[model samples]
Target: MPFILTRITRDGLSRLMAKYVVGQIVCHERGWMDTHMKQIKKDCIGWHTFHSFRSLDQLTVGVMGLGKIGLTTAKVLKGFGCRVHGLVRTPRSHSSVEPFVDQLWHGREGLADFLKDCDYLVNLMPSTPLTHGLLGDEVLTGASRRPVIVNVGRGDIITEADLLKALEQGWIFAAVLDCYEKEPIPEDSFLWTHPRVVMTPHNSYNNNEDYKRHHIQTEFIVNFENFLAGQPLTGEVDWQTGY
Candidate 1:
């Protein structure tokens, strides 16, 4: 699996970034901790309504790419009693995640339906020619529940302009993006101070402890040894599919 940057949308010039790995180092559920605290801080010592905070049990989470990492995220959401739906290229009876997802959708045809009633939509889709600019005004505006958009996937999959438009029009509740169509996202970008958006510097795939754990290095060495022995590698990349 690899992460790639195809073309710069706003800047018209060509710039690229690449990564080769099957797993992500980011476990942003930790960042959700800070988000919750920030929300509380914003509320201040104001009078509290009994229903000010919605319980996790009342929410439904939709994951856009139900691969290995997505499945792991679904498990966490399930633990919160959320009804989790996953969007996959194909819904398989034998998929390890089938048991975790309450519903499944396939391809672009299934995207609108998947966003229909979700309280939160998590994007984990890989970048490819087919997926570039996939989540734009039409898709966000179609979301019936006005769900919060959380993007930890490739940035080019969604456009910042469309996202801003969607937010301004109340097409979506808010957005939390760990990556962007252009990164080291331009300092002048309004997203830096946008009330409806939370931006992080493309660090979703980084963790200080990851290296200490030998998580990636160990896996690479083992796979290399397997290759030397003519055994199966941990992952395979199909240039056409781009996964």
Candidate 2:
């Protein structure tokens, strides 16, 4: 061990103030933790704990899309302690989901600023013709601060190249990927090597299989009632949007 090590201490900021170091390491003369409190705070990030930012006080969380899961996740986070915002197309409708979002933004350029203050970015956008490769460099460009990204939606929404660039270039702080451009991410893939990245098969929103019969019966009952009433069927497919 080098005795030439330099130990510096100051009181500009308290250790309890940091998000990473949760409380102080208490020292006990017997089996001691060697606890000593001095203000030498560097910076706290990705800290989740009792005294960490996990409690969500003063935390900004942004959801990229306002779909079922997205809206639910935002609301759940708010119940805990975070300020939740949503990115939806402009002129959103009034709903319980709206109240959950502290703010809303629309379009790609809007995303840049919408995510500026966010500590966590939850992407729930569906993969469509326009949304294929949406999270490319143009959108990830100039992000003021890196935020932890959790992608529970379609993978094609974010391109393989763009996701690679985002990680290597530090556009996003870290990622929790449950889907990908390729289902079987190649053994040679960059995502496998990236230390800050987490990967999983697309299974976050597992369908309720036990309700399969109920779902079928429910749909049939509604449509059957409409048929009996001689009314137009609901859930007409949108050929143009291919929904």
The prediction achieving the highest lDDT against the true structure is 1
In model 1, the runs with Cα more than 4 Å from the true position are 1-51, 94-96, 210-213
Residue pairs in collision within model 1: none
Root-mean-square deviation per candidate: 8.4, 16.8
Number of the predicted model whose TM-score against the real structure is largest = 1
Q: lDDT at 150 for candidate 1?
A: 79
lDDT of 2 by residue, 57-122 (tens): 556778777755566666666765678877865456546466778888876657777877876777
What is candidate 1's lDDT per residue for 1-243, written digit by digit as tens?
Answer: 554212212110100111201111122222443455557788544323233345666878888887666776776667767789888766565366767788888888888888889878878888888789878757778788888777888888778888888888888888878788997788888789887687767665555665425655666667778778988666565667787
> What are the Cα lDDT values of the candidates?
0.68, 0.60
TM-score of each candidate? 0.77, 0.66
